[model samples]
Target chain A: MHNPSQSGASLEISDLSKAYGSFKALDAVSLTARQGEFLSLLGPSGSGKTTTLNMIAGFTSPTSGEIRVDGREISTLPPYRRDIGIVFQHYALFPHLTAAQNIAFPLQRRGMPRRDVAVRVAEALEMVKLDGYGDRYPRQLSGGQQQRVAFARAVVFKPKLLLMDEPLGALDKKLREDLQGEIRRIHRSLGITFVFVTHDQEEALALSDRIAVFNHGRIEQIGTSRELYETPATEFVARFIGEANIFSGTLVRGDAGLALDTPVGLLPVETRLPAGRQASLVVRPERLEIGKAPHAGSDPHVPATVRDVVYLGSNRRIEIVFDDGRTGIIRGSGRGTDVGAGERIDIRWSIADGYVVPFSSSQTGDGHGS
Target chain B: MLNDTRLRWLILFVPVAVLGVFFWYGVADSLWKSFASPEIGLQNYAAFLQSPAEMAVLRRTFLVSIGVTAVCLAFGYPYAYLMTVTTARLRTLLMVVVLIPFWTSMMVRTYAWVALLQNNGPLDRVFKSLGIGGLALIGTPGAIMIGITQILMPFMIMSLYANMVRIDRRLLDAADSLGASPAVAFVKVFVPMTVPGVVAGCTLVFVLSLGFYLAPVLLGSPQHAMLSQLIVQQVSQLLDFGRAGAMAGVLLALALSVVALGAVLARPAIERGYGENT
Candidate 1:
């Protein structure tokens, strides 16, 4: 039990934005972190997540809005004065400095006593589990080793907010998983506020206490991983976070509940849209059940043909072409089940599993995998 | 491209033959003359060694060389750093400014400095307004220093810029985010990172300064004569080839020794930094 407020501070970003000429990179994005939460800003490339991180780190000045750490306005402050730590995408360890020296740099710069700097540096190295790697140069280490050194350097001085911009993006899968575990361990022990920016949705879901999904310079939704995955507010959030089979149609009032009349049949949804407006409904691939026609008490059912069956290890991805000439994908564990391409199958999802989203005709029926 | 061993040997033989004919041949003759002098056994070498006037000239040459190297480092390091950090269009403009002296003839640039540092010239007028007009700058060690540094600053700037651009700028960002102020970050992280560039650039400037004759001859007086000029005096005025050869040999040995010592000191750092940056 480390108390974060002793070393970490709360952060509030209110109506913050940045623009390049006529192009807006960030548009009035706001977020907050209570003292020791791991908040991830998740988005695709150029979706303003990295821009927001840069603004918070004071590397790029905002065109408007304010960033406050524990109510101290820091938008006008330079990066060095902000007392934050950032681990870059490529671990920018000073190649000239040995591992221990790299960790000691910040301590020395603060004019900490030489003996204490040495002690703290050793402690930081051990915190990253690199106990005897103090004498090696950066190039002499492997990528994973360098990444650990970077984490140690960033956290050595106990910064209030440790900002990481896709710090694990460059590593291979095995190394990334290993470092993610190490980062989680460090976060648990240090209790520092971590503002991580990444495009990897799974990584965000695995690490974040809260995820702010960004798109086109605006935050689509901000919530926990479960909240964002289970109930996405907008169509972009629904399609961006997980595997979703999205259908677009006219919103129609129905007997049982609200429904959308589309090529995939009228889908009874839990959310109601404005009358007669074009609406979209999202049913996650895992939510759809494939079998015979549903009983009367069961949810809405659709007649579909199996166009393709992709054998994923634990689950088989069955691509369904609906009777109305539209397509959908359903993922389920198909052990001992005989399912092949061109097989006629019946698909249905519970009304509660369907989330009705405000649909723009701009992005119509397409499968999105994040 | 030169994977063929015969072709590689043939290509190397040309430079080796040319070097043997013009360079190594002259150096070998000089070494022979330095030892097998007027008495054929250490007479002229002893005269050259025991002379205080000659030793004083050698000492002053080294001082000027070191002073010029220090001045170049001061100016070139920041300028090269700016080149790396600026935008592309601005970088091109800065590059043109740095290369102006390099492209212009060395004699032409030295003369330009002479005109400026002479009495009532552009620099002299400014100095005169500052009430330092009485200080003679035209034919002194200071003028020669200015001229040499100006001519050699480009070498330092180019060398450092080539290495500085390769420095991962994110390291500076990392340092700043680690709570070091911008100036402190520059000193602790950025300066040490560019050590290889500094070592290479300073060695180039120092060695070039040791053998520089034209700028010193044109900008400095007889009282400020460097070893190159002293050797020229020995041969042209004193008609003493053996003594001048010995002096030239000594100057060559000194320059090589400085380069060797600098490389020895900078080897580990260069090896470490270049491995990552490249």
Candidate 2:
């Protein structure tokens, strides 16, 4: 029940639920966006991210809920009256109009003078670095250029809020990265509330001031990128954000915090646990240390046999199988220390590098355990 | 190479040979016969071009075809838009209804219009019961127009529906989110996007209307003879082959020129409507 402050055009959605007959598209979803903040809704396909966006855009109504912007109830307002800007995945520019005309579409609707609309259209196109392209039809421009025109057309009228649904999904990888940075820059410059939807985790992490990670029609976690990445509240969040090696074990009392008795070895962890409870330990691959020795007992080391080694340019990923037949991945920067398949090595990680997560049947079925 | 060349020549020449013998021969023979006797050379064509009655019939035919094309485009656009937005099951059902008219013979549909428009028919009786008299709709140009419109509307709807279905729904949403109301979106985005469909439907309806015979002859009066009806009267009633030949040639030329002009005028709209780069 978070109510956004009314100082600016903040959007507050609460208890938003939508169902299509028997299938629930969004299940009691709720979130809020402060004015001028770039908030991204990040999720995989069928995770209800687009559904939540469509609800906010007023293209689709919530089966039951409240959507308020600037402290005014706009749940039932038609999309046109909502005065929101939206950039689609396919960049729906009018084929008959040039870039300038497309940008002037919304302004013309407001009955602005032709000269004023022209000035604003030029400004919008310049903002997107497409100033000289105003006279060219969308067909004459490249895909990336057309996408910029779509962005200009959406924001030319200076709407209160902007919605982008996978706006970079159709671009090449390098172009997508470039546009992601450009979008963040524009958001900062315009200081308008932007609600972006994407299934790519890296895009969300790179661009959003705050991200709402969705799963199974519900928000699994919503926090700053660092907070969500470092201290994920659930196993789904931990695995979705980055690669993680999870281990199933029982917790025992330790001097520092707790100890997990896994099949590979007894490992220390930096999380509180009931003395005799079952828990799962999750650690990032980059946090693991692989070497010839355990470095004078800095941390408990488990002997493992190298199974596979993959070169990833900046880093090398080594897949290893422990003596107890448990497999895990360790990522390290490229170095002279070469390890091949079937070679024995010792893997070590600090207790503070891992967190305790609740074990679920579905989590075990994913086969992501170390 | 020789075998392939022989196969290609066979494929090309069979149709050309049949067309030359069956179609061209008959048309040439008609032209020859039209000038064979009784003031030959250009007399029949001169008579057809000079007579005010013939001129009036040709003008009426053009007016009726243009009118029917306009009526079909006006009604078919909204019907096609509705079909595009409806549920799949409902859209299929409505499409079936639009196409069912085509499955029945055009003559049967025109006859149905005749039965409905007569003084003692269901429509006239309803109008009479509603206290609206002095209609006198039967055997009039208005009745002929109605019959032509009804018979030709399905072609317009089907052609427009095919093109409308290909439009991306996201464009409409983009328009709405940019502050265009639903009505504005339809007029600015949807209507412009379906211009090719409009052109195609209009051309089809107009060309078909130009050549219509049974409907105008059955539903129209003697004074309302269209171009085709006049051609039939010249050839059969008056036994004037040259005049009929001239009229037929003029009708063919007019229909083809209109089609060519429509295609030229519609080029930009079609390109704009369908170009994916936009």
Candidate 3:
């Protein structure tokens, strides 16, 4: 059944729309996934990430759309007939069956020989490193163990595609990180297409080869993590992906790129932008430097008061009160930074580290960034 | 601290005293009366055990009760599952329909069954209209079974529905995504999860059927006399309180044993269900 030459399957979704009465859960959503790629649907709560997943999994029918797997339309197929595996956020293990029986359920349904079923079940359990726990019922297992059993059951059938809906959302931070690595490793070993849904930006960025950031039933941006983080097309993407310090200002003229004239000073833009456009400059917290010697012949120097200083283990996060009264964060190695609260300091960043995002009136007012 | 302790003991003792005087004393008095009658040496119990007529009634009662409980479970489980999976409005309507039969008295419900099942009643009339013969449905064991099932089905459905509704829906979805069909998911995931409710409902229906009087009295013939009807006959007609007490004791013992067995059987399922859900 293994076909090395036909390893990848392309999934194409076109103009998918789903509505619960008047409320549009998913609106004209469309995307494509190359085989053997890990794609994440990243969004906040009620942002249609799970809806999109349900549609792809055949658990839900889109109001209007088409889904084609390897160029074969499967939009109307039932979930079981679709031959796709899914892992839920709650790790829904069968309570009556032991881990081995749960993993063997699909194989048994297909009427495989008893000996072959046993071997495959054992292999699946071993793949999840749960070899010794085959006889344990779901209730006897811990949360992480149950999640691993769920993963084993999903992958036991070697499905063409796998859908995971916030599968690690219930685990603790340490466990979540551990299982994230485990899931990535499993994906690599299996070389199966995986579409994951998560509201957690860090998890999505860490695991996804490409991510589709969703907001209010629409895709704000879809790109690789580096592309989305370094050059976000919209303010939502900029704020959702990482901590972005946004300064609302009008674009000003500069020799190399556009500059932002804000309450602090003229903030130089990292990426070139159209001049005289109303824009907001985005600077990642780690990119901004505090208490460093000024670069030679830099034009803009914004002096600000240190509102607060938080001691992170690796770096000191300093909150600066700009001359116009907005706050910005700057990260420095804790050893060299002696700037305390109420002290005046000069905060600066390299011109290439700050980029301009289009100013939107509906953006959140928290100036300390995303 | 001393006053608080005294008040707490006083509060606890009040209910304990009330229960002891009002409940335990009556049962103990009945047990003493059962054993101590007509020369007082387990004569009533020996007579009850030795009499084939009495033994037949006991056997028939157990059979009928088991039959009724089985029927209730067979029908109630799917109804409960549908209630859990349906939309909220439809579920509420279905629940109301299940409960609507309970608002009327059991005797009235039994009489309604009589009206529907009698030879010249609506059921027979419908059969006759279809060119079929009028069937014998009343004053038989079948009538008693139907009446009991109709009255007892709600208890099973409501109990099972409560448990089934509380099940995590994600569990069912998970089974589906793992390539199990709907039927497989229901049998593997849902049926096992609702085992506690099924056991509870079965126990309740069985124990209640064991002591049934009205439905059997009204719908069954003299040959189909249940334990409760026999006890009433011994006390009221034969004026044999000793035999009646012995019969009552048997019924109580059977009911208690069944309840204990049910608790023992249901504990693991309940623990596993709750454990997995949590």
Q: Top TM-score: which candidate number?
A: 3
Each prediction's TM-score versus the true structure: 0.90, 0.90, 0.91
**On residues B144-259, what C-alpha lDDT tens digit does candidate 2 reach at each position?**
88999988999999889888898888889988988889999989988888877787888889999998998898888888888989888888998977778888877877888988
Chain A TM-score, cand. 1: 0.94
How many clashes does each candidate structure show, in the order listed?
0, 0, 0
Best by DockQ: 2
Q: Tell me the lDDT of model 1 at A249.
A: 87
Interface Cα RMSD for all candidates? 1.4, 1.5, 1.7
Instruction: Point out where model 1 deviates above 4 Å.
Output: A4-8, A255-257, A292-298, A302-308, A320-327, A335-337, A361-370, B1-3, B37-44, B86-90, B113-135, B233-241, B274-278
Per-residue lDDT tens digits for candidate 1, residues A54-168, read: 9999889999998999899999898888889889999889888899998998888788999999999999998888999999999789889999999899888888789999999
Model 2 over residues A1-370: C-alpha lDDT tens digits?
Answer: 1232322268898999999999998999989999988899988787899999998889999999899998899988999899889999889998877889899999999999999998899889989999798888887898899999999998888877888999998889999889888998888777788999988888888999999988878898899999888888777778888777777778887675578888977787767567677877888888888777544664756788899999888889989887788788889885523789988888877767888876644532332211
Candidate 3 off by > 4 Å? A1-8, A254-257, A270-272, A291-296, A334-336, A364-370, B1-19, B114-136, B274-278
Task: Rank the candidate models, highest TM-score first.
Answer: 3, 2, 1
**Superposed Cα deviation of residue A258, candidate 2 (Å):** 1.6
Better of 2 and 3 by lDDT: 2
